[model samples]
Target: MTSSDPGALHAQTLSEAPCGRRLFIHALNAASGEGQEWVARLRELGFIEGEPVQVLRRGQPGGEPLAVRVGVSTFALRRAEAACIQVMPADAS
Candidate 1:
């Protein structure tokens, strides 16, 4: 991935993305059936690829289960669960 190329930039996992920065769902990094489950679950929760999300809060000042907003719904997720979600800056190409 190249920093200068928005298209080439590697997607950031939701667990590592800075709080308050809007992100676009880019991919699901889970493996095989696990990935499908995650993708289905996320989709059921309104978190499909190309949708916008933002980190709304953190747990225990610094812990798992980050609270995020997708569309008009807000939900909390553990770091491991969120790690499967790859995202890009919302305003990026």
Candidate 2:
């Protein structure tokens, strides 16, 4: 995968993000991180380390908006924005 490609970096879903995996903020397109608002929101939503995330959907064809579940809330984030966040498969088994 290219250095700027988030989706290309990994191909696993949230349900597969087990419990002790390490995931990187690959992208977050329209989610917005300006002024750290998005970052704060994400943390509040439980998008922190050791948290499990599942990829509900890949958004549209371009992968702009993706449906992901962090902790108990599901959010639709833009590709560019998703690229900023990082994550790893929680399940190592």
Candidate 3:
């Protein structure tokens, strides 16, 4: 919440979220075409508003796919996909 950028507190994509951080879904930036498919898939995976999400693991230094826990399920997402999930720090929420 102390981040210089106010949006950093209110909203930031999961890709930028630190590992082991617990957060809440603020919104999902569902897009068209390929992203539209991801949006639908993510929704089916239970990436919805108000639900808690946690960054469990991440790819090595490259940081490609990130493993995350959403609700009671765990899934791996590419940084591009993770970037569409906007969330707020758990404490702030």
Candidate 4:
């Protein structure tokens, strides 16, 4: 991958991932308190390592709610929640 690519050798948070590119779950960033809850919920929703994920669409200009598909399930996640998911490009692995 090129240097400009966010998922070249490292993981990028889902919220900052470019739309329409197929990516894979690299890791989950679990913070304290509510952030941990979000991460846990995300895991329960099938956001796991090695799983394929894609950014279907984004909300308006600000890009708050992101339409993301993980495996065979799609979810609408806010930027904050999406940030909990760390993903790498499909070819990274």
Candidate 5:
């Protein structure tokens, strides 16, 4: 049997990362009650980690607005807001 290559593992980890891809909530960071509410809304929209999400569309060439889809719902999010979210690749394998 072939053992997993450490380099391959690391590459996978980086490539499957959600850093550049719009992803589901996965988990929420510390925040105020209002912040939690907003996070909850995102969750309700299927912004949970491991959920299928795609960058359905992007806003202006270099704008913050981006169209993302969680399940069947599509929402627009700012780059800063998107950064708060962490996600795993939908096609990790």
Candidate 6:
């Protein structure tokens, strides 16, 4: 990743974030082949760049679904969906 890349510089997929820690949206990656619709839907749900988010909890066992909070809303997302979202430490900026 380059310096100009928003997903670079201490960035990591949201699914990998630790529960209860504050994080900020860095960028969205469509490389997973989830299509533009998936990206658009995530954005529509307030998963925009610079938005603060938190991984509230992860499902037991395989950790398929993750409970996340963005802005004023919270939603459960599959690990694949959460993988599409890049995030950084809330103190990075």
Maximum-lDDT candidate: 6
Score candidate 6 by lDDT: 0.89
lDDT of 2 by residue, 26-89 (tens): 3332234382676666666666655656666664576547677766677876655454465544
Candidate models: Cα lDDT each: 0.81, 0.53, 0.85, 0.87, 0.52, 0.89
Error of 4 at 6 (Å): 14
- lDDT (10s digit) by residue, model 5, range 1-93: 123633223222111333346433344432445556666766767677467666665566775476777678778876655544545444432
lDDT of 6 by residue, 1-93 (tens): 578865496899998999999999988877456546778899999999999999999998888699999998999999889988989998886
Best-to-worst TM-score order: 6, 4, 3, 1, 5, 2
Q: What's every prediction's RMSD, in angstroms? A: 3.2, 7.4, 4.1, 4.5, 7.5, 1.7
Clashing pairs in 4: none
Better of 4 and 6 by lDDT: 6
Candidate 3 lDDT by residue in tens digits, 11-93:
98898889998999877876446888787788889999789998898988898789999999999998999987889988786
* Model 5 lDDT at residue 63: 54
Pairs that collide, model 3: none
lDDT of 1 at 29: 66
Report the lDDT tens digits of candidate 1 across residue range 1-93.
346755537588889988899888887667455777876788789888889989888899567689999998999998877887878997785
**Candidate 4 least-lDDT 10 residues:** 1-10
By the TM-score metric, which is better: model 1 or model 5?
1
Model 4, TM vs. native: 0.86
- Predicted candidate 3, C-alpha RMSD: 4.1
What is the lDDT, from 0 to 100, of the residue 24 in candidate 4? 93
For model 6, the stretches where C-alpha displacement exceeds 4 angstroms are 1-7
Query: Which structure among the candidates has the greatest TM-score?
Result: 6
